[model samples]
Target: MTFLLLVLAIASEVTATVSLKLSEGFTKLVPSIIVVAGYGGAFFFLSQTLKRGMSIGVAYGVWSAIGVAAVATIGALFLDESLTAVQMGGIVLVIVGVLALELGAAH
Candidate 1:
């Protein structure tokens, strides 16, 4: 349940971040509202995940890393953004770093 909540939190955060770009500095009403709601839900679920006893390091690391990667992909795919080789490598590194954190936590 906690893991699931954490995933939700990450998704919500990513959605909010993407919406932020679409919001155009909060000029757009709908995406601006979405940004607020998405971020609100994200923090709510993230707090729940922490309350469920997941370590802060693991939870936040996973959440942030996944959020960064997701947002980057979304930006590139839908927002006409560039995804250079260096950016792709950075995304891979973020995933790898998260995996290493999870592995380290196991023992």
Candidate 2:
């Protein structure tokens, strides 16, 4: 249940981020609304996850790490954005760091 909530938070954050790009400085109406709603949903779900006994450090680390990776991949694939080798490495490192946090929490 907590993991599902975290996934919802991550998805909301990623959607908000992608909508931010599509919003074009809020010039577009639909995406702008999505930006607000997505962020709100993200926070709400994230809070639910924390309330379910997940540590702040682990929850935030996983949420942000996965968000970054997903947004970057979506941008590169659909928005004509570039994802360089270095950035890819950084994403990998972020995921690894989040994994370390999760693992460390298990002990």
Candidate 3:
């Protein structure tokens, strides 16, 4: 299903972004490879989902927004990155935007 593929694309993109940090500036071979492959698969599947009827603008907006949020969370949890209150509020806004986009696409 297109929805499932879209979800996979978002997940793969998030995984790839997290792996990018683990890649250590691409010095670590394995993590670097994971980043490359994960992003490749994500885009490939996203293309398929688009072909399956989802609007490109809506799909890309949701994907990028969710990917950014997930990667930020991963950085906070695993990399011990500090998220200021303002940054946290920004992430919440991104989520709200994604939800609004999805709702608009439903009509």
Which candidate tops TM-score?
Answer: 2
Clashing pairs in 1: none
Q: Local error of candidate 3 at 39, Å? A: 0.8
Per-residue lDDT of 12 in model 3: 90
Task: Write one digit per residue (lDDT tens) for candidate 1, span 1-107.
Answer: 99999999999999999999999999999999999999999999999999999988899999999999899899999999999999999989988998899999999
Please identify model 2 stretches exceeding 4 Å from their true place: none
Model 2 TM-score on a 0 to 1 scale: 0.98
Give each model's clash number: 0, 0, 0
Model 2 RMSD in Å is 0.6
Instruction: Kindly report which residue stretches of model 3 are placed more than 4 angstroms away from their true locations once superposed.
Output: none
* Structural similarity to truth (TM-score) of each candidate: 0.96, 0.98, 0.91
Minimal lDDT window, size 10, model 1: 91-100
Tell me how many residue pairs clash in candidate 3.
0
For residues 10-69, what per-residue lDDT tens digits would candidate 3 score against the true structure?
A: 999998888899999999999999999999989998999999999987889889888887
Q: Name the lDDT of candidate 2.
A: 0.97
Which structure among the candidates has the greatest lDDT? Answer: 2
